[model samples]
Target: MAREKKYREAVNWKKELRLFPGYLILLIWISFTFVLLGWVLLASFSTTKEIFSNKLLASGLHFENYVKAWINSDVAGIFRNSLVYSIIACSLLIVICAPAAYVLSRFIFPGNKLIQTGFVSAMGVPVVMIVLPLFGIVANLGILNHVLSNGMLLIFLYIGINIPYTTIFLMTFFGNLSRAFEEAAAIDGCPPTKTFWLIMLPMAQPGIITVTIFNFINIWNEYFISLIFANSDQLRPIAVGLYSMINSMKYTGDWAGMFAAVVIVFLPTFILYIFLSEKIIAGVTGGGVKG
Candidate 1:
C-alpha cells in the first residue's frame, strides 16, 4: 500500500509538471494586464510632462485631471449620451428578445429553424457591410439631427444590431429551463404568455442580467455605428468622444486628462464585472449543467 501510494503521488506530480507551461503563460498574461492597468491609473494622476518623462506619481495626485477630463474635455455630456443609449437599448433588447427567445425555445412553428439560422448567421456578417445602407435609409427618412427623434433612431439601431446576440443567448437559457414549470402554470389556468412572463423569465434572471450587462458594456463603448449615425459632439458616446479627444491631444497635450477619461469610461464595466462576475459564470454554465 505504501508503494502504491508513492506511485500515485509521483503520477500526480508528473501531471502537474505537464501543466506548468500553461500555468506560467497564464501568470505572465495576468501580470502584464495588471501592470498595464496600474500604469494607466498612475498616469491618470501624473502630469503629461511627467508621464512622458517616465516620472509617474511625481506630481503627487492631481485631482484636477479628472475635472478637466470631465468638464473641459466635454466628457460629461458624452457620458450621459452613452448612459441613455445603453439604458434604452438594453431595455428594448430584453423586451423584444425575451419573448422571442422563449417562443423559439418552447414552440414549434413554421420557419422557426430558418429564423434561428438567420439570427446566428447575422452574427457573422460584418457591420461595415450594413452601415452604408443603413446610413442611406436614415438619411432618406429626413430625421438626421432632430434631437429626440435621432436619439430614438440611435436606440433602435442599437437594439436592431444587438437583437441577434441577445436572442441567441436567451434562447439557450430558456431552452435549458424545465417544462415542468410551464405545465404547473397551465394547471393553475395561466395562459402561455403569462406563464412565460411570470414563470420562465423569473427563472432566467441570471441569464437576463448577464446579457444585460454585456449589452450595456457593448453599447456604452460602441463606436462605429454611433460614429456614423451620431457624429455631432452633443450626441457622441464615450467611444467616439474619446477618439475626438485623442485627435485633439496633439494640441491639448493633456495626456493625464486623457487617461482620466479612459478610466472614467472603463469604470462602469470594471465595477460591474467585479460585482456580477459570478452571475455571468452561472448564466453561461447553467444551461450546460442540466444537459
Candidate 2:
C-alpha cells in the first residue's frame, strides 16, 4: 500500500502544479486523436448506411471494403507509384547528401559557409514562386506528355527540392561524429572516401534513418508537385490519386470504401513511425564520442 501510494504520485501534482495545465492539454489532444482514429477505423468496415446512421460495425466485418478500394478504385497503382518514388528519392538523397554534408561539416574550404547559407536560403523559398517557371520549362520541353519522362521529371523535382533539407539535416549528424574515427582510419591506411563509406557513415546510421524517414514521408505525401507534373493518370502518386478517388467516391456514395482507402494510405507512415520512433529520437539528441 505504501508503494502503491508512492507510485500514484509519480506525476507529483503537488510539486509540479505548474505543469498540470500542459499535461491536461496533452491528455485532451491524445483523447481526441484516439476518438478520431477509432471512428475512422470503425467506419472503414461499416456500410454506408451504418456510417450515416453512426451505427458502425453493426453488420459483420466487411473485408470487401478493402478489396473494392484496392482493386476497383486503383489504389494499388498510386500506392505503388508513391512507394517507388519515395524509396528511390530517399536512397538518392542519402547518397548525394552524405558526401556533401561530410565535406561541409568537416572541411574548411573557401566559400563553404556561403554554400551552406545558399542551401538554407533555398529552403526558405516558397514552392509557389518556382512552380510556374518549372511548369513552363517542362511544358516547353514537351516531356510532360511522355509517360516515362513525366515520371522521371517528378522524381527529379522531388530530389531537387529535397536536397537542401537533406544536406542540412545530415550535416548536423556528420558534424556530431568524432574526428578520431577518421584519424584512426588514416593511421591504418584507409582512404578518406573509404573511411567515410566504411566507418563514419555506418556510425551515423541513427541520423540517416531519421532523416530518410522524414524524406520518405515528404515524398510520399507530396501532392502539389505530383499534381502539376504527373500529367497522366498512371503517373499519379497516392495523394493526388487518392484525392481523385475520394472525389469519384463522393459521386458513388461509398463511404466505407473511402475510409478503407484512407486507412490504406495512412498505414505506411504509421507503421514506419511505430518501428523507428526510437531511432528518430536517438538521432535528434545523440552523437558519437571520442575515446
- On TM-score, the candidate that comes out on top is 2
For candidate 2, the 10 contiguous residues with the lowest summed lDDT are 282-291
Clashing pairs in 1: none
- 149-170: candidate 1 lDDT, tens digit per residue: 7778889999999998899888
Specify the highest-lDDT model's number. 2
In candidate 2, which residue ranges exceed 4 Å CA deviation?
1-22, 281-291
Q: Give residue 13's lDDT in candidate 1 (0 to 100).
A: 96
**C-alpha lDDT values of all predictions:** 0.87, 0.89
In model 1, which regions exceed 4 Å deviation? Answer: 1-20, 281-291
lDDT score at residue 179, model 1, on the 0-100 scale? 94
Give one clash count per candidate, in the order shown: 0, 0
lDDT of 2 by residue, 75-184 (tens): 99999999989988899989999899999999999999999998888888888988999999999999998999999999989998998888888888889889999999
